[model samples]
Target: MTTSAALTVRVVTSLEEFKGLACEWERLLRTVPGHSFFVTWEWLYYWAKHYLRGNQLKILFVFDDRKRLIGIAPFYLRMTSVYGLISVRELRLLGSETVCSSYLDFIVNEQHKPAVLRGLYEYLFGEARKTWDVLTLSELAAESSTLDLWNELFDEAGKVGEVVGTSCCPVIRLPGDVDTYHAGLGRNRRYTLQRKTKCLQRAGRMEYARITSPREIDAAFESLVSLHQRRWGTRANGGVFADDVSRRFHREVVQVLSERGRVSLDLLTLDGRPIAAIYGFVYGETYYFYLPGFDPTAVPKASPGLLLLHHRIEQAIREGMTTVDLLQGAQPYKLEWSTGRQSLVTVRYYNRHARAVALKLGEGVKQAIKILVR
Candidate 1:
């Protein structure tokens, strides 16, 4: 714990204590600017519940003098082996790389970001420094305020930190109407979309369904998994929903968020047979295009996956959504439809301990070897 005249910081280590902070967490998240579905209580809590077995939670809470919650650093400690030899304790954000979570940061009130961050820094580096060898913060948005603030803090303290580009999230800003959006696309792209739609429609009766009911989520979600696997199973990197744990995690998240009208599980069916499916969410004014699957055997030339995405975009525009977030990928298909992109970065800080220094040296050697080989 750490305190100042206006701010106080406390760490929540137990699962029960973390569970009790749900309401407060949600409230604090809402006060954040551009808060997305990834940071919601449902997403992170369920993620922790499913993936927290081998790790220790180190969630930090910052509060005002009146005991009101002002910020939350959803962190966890994990023991990682360097080259399967040296064991190093890593202090990482809760929703790290495993589940492809993006826009991760400390949930802080805009007004008190500086003070809250200072409080968190004081506790992590001042009081709890020895608990971890390296601090790994990943998937932060390009323009995230935490980036600059933390960099400043590190510079002021003469601590070396590395920031590297991790991935890109392409986004499509929607207009008020679908026609207006179509008009903005390039001629060749627009022609391709039209031709695909017409080709698919000529084959059979096409229908788009958005599944949100809790009772219907299980079936819809499973359909998404099946199509997803069929599409990606033969590739070098298989489907994300291939494992039982990933399936269960997403199913629960979709089901819970469905009750709150936050889930959008869409399927494009031809003659009542599902061909393409998209598992996404509707948060704020944005439609998050999280995952998609399409039957390669079903109208392959017509491109069911692309057609399904077009239908979702049309629906989003009609329903007044401002953006369609193709989360955490720079695939050709995603870039074709994207009007803009959000850059994501990973920040790493190493302590001066021998273990951390060894780890840093190991990383440098690996980079040097890669460069020489190239």
Candidate 2:
């Protein structure tokens, strides 16, 4: 472990420092256990450097006594229309839109999350208490220990901290081989699995292929893009694979993750040609369902995407993964396999102004629509 005498905490408020810190942050991330490509220096840097045009993205870093990076918290100071239509400031991590981003929260060294969060809140809330109205975070993973800490801190602060919103995330527990998992799903789901596997087998030699090395990453990426484009065409949200940024990010993520042997880029192929691919991460005992695509032309009969998922789950069971997390989604199929749902909540910490109230109203509107649909 690195020494702590030279340890220092800095909040990079300027773009120049932000850029420099990102370089260091990424370098350290590669060494951190379970570091994800999404939180990689390049991924976050590219997004912040591009989308943050005039948007103040404040990046905070914690250096050990040796001046070596140990933690990072990527956040932004921005103006939204909710706070009385005024430019009331707040700090938040860069994440997907409510309609899109699956989850949110900062990436810190697993060992340093507690320290980083404490330092981050101190600086953000301490300095901006007079100028900013809120300090909000969204889509935090329910299983994360940081969420538990946040709850404790909120209680200690004696300030208003609310769950605000909650949503379900489904997961599959994989034990032993695919056959064992199939048997565990019980009569109905097991029957469907048997039928689907048979149908898929009749269509072609259904084989599950995983791109496990950096050497295979390029070809696997091309296969993923080709199938994704063919599957979604113009209707699928272009943000995923339609643009250079996203495509490049995915490639880099796969390469990095494959290097660690923690990424599962599973492909369903017929004969020798690829038809469907599911890109996800297998960390510890959890398999994260990140992204997937298939050839639309081969749908109905092939059902490549669904078949690939089936195979992936089976593989996970064989690998002894305890959970196959669907991440965030309301997909009916996810419910079909998931026996339990992990509830997630969103919260915002405020210093002043009516921003909290406006946010609550927006939440109410969202809830009303959800209730109406249900």
Candidate 3:
């Protein structure tokens, strides 16, 4: 049966083909409800160029009858291990996991999302005949509209899927100004901010600035990454800057996004020295609290990192932002300031292949061991 006669699918198999979708990619982002700079071509392409490292890339596109793009599934197949098994072709979303591209999904234009998803699945299982052992999609918001739509589609097909909870993303619904925002905060956060601000002011000359110029981006972002590494220092399974590849990838993305006004790399300076920084991004009316760093030597009273966070929240409100996404972490600070939460899940689908069967069995055995231990 024709999945959707009005829609046609295209598979991009190489880097050159992927680059050609730049114009169409930007146009499609404008048609979606959830605005995220991390998912944009600027971010994804840079990530692919640096981090992909010879993985086979498979990009699927869904177009309407007029050949206008309606959806994009930027995916790649890579080798992974399961239960001592090696060389498994796992399909996953582009710019996912290692890049920390929050809220990843198929970029489906809302107007034709249903048809696009259905068309995409048809292409995956039908015409293309993908022999992928398992498909893994991660960092999708718990409330993701795409998750809901595809879940329904998969359920109808009687396919078994697994959704593992990953992270808790807290969000704040802004109310115009700093004063109002402070009023809505929990007592602890309210007092913490007030006390910390006074201490920070007394400490030295504190200056908070958001840099967006391409000329200034490189230097400022480099400093931000440095602070982040120093503060983390081989903790939390190693910071994002632990690997040189991720650092370079971010440098490229920041430079591009800063020019387009999609990024706000905030640096908080004290006594003419950089003490803290926050990597922030904007898409539509939403502000993403992407990454952060602070001087380890700074006193707790100054709360340099906390202060920058507070300032950015206020700045976002003043900018007329409707929501502040704290990205994919559930730290106590995020809980204190956040009024709501979003969960990211990993959806794994298996094919009727030897590799897939081995993975499913490995998972079953692993689950049994975990249960026995508990």
- Cα-based lDDT for every prediction: 0.86, 0.67, 0.81
Q: Which is the better candidate, 1 or 3, if ranked by TM-score?
A: 1
- What is the descending TM-score order? 1, 3, 2
Model 1, poorest ten-residue lDDT window? 365-374
Pick by TM-score: which candidate is best? 1
Regions of model 3 farther than 4 Å from truth: 1-6, 186-189, 365-374
After superposing candidate 1 on the true structure, give the runs of residues whose Cα lies further than 4 Å from its correct spot.
Answer: 365-374
Question: Which tens-of-lDDT digit does each residue in 62-164 have in candidate 3?
Answer: 7788777788888988888776655677899988858667888888866787788888777776766555877888888777778888878777876656785
Error of 3 at 62 (Å): 1.1
* Ranking of candidates on lDDT, top first: 1, 3, 2
Summing lDDT over every window of 10 consecutive residues in candidate 2, give the lowest-scoring window.
Answer: 365-374
Residue range 1-374, candidate 2, lDDT tens digits: 11223345666776666666655776776656644334555446656654565668676677766666677777777766664564556666665332234445576657777766666556555654565666667666667676878767656765555565667778776666766666677898667767877877887777789888889877987888888787775775753677776675567767766877767778988777888988788776777888788887763565678878877887777777878888777689888878677766677765534554455456575533332233
Better of 1 and 3 by lDDT: 1
Candidate 2 lDDT for residue 107: 66
lDDT of 2 at 33: 63
What is candidate 1's lDDT per residue for 1-374, written digit by digit as tens? 64564677888888888878888888888888798788888888888988888899999888888898889989999998878989999999887857999898889867888888878777777778888888988999878889999888877877768874588999998989978988898799889988988898999999999898999988999889999999998888678976788888988898899999999999999999899999998999999999999999998878999888988999999889999999998999899889999999999987656667667767686533332233
Candidate 3's TM-score reads 0.92
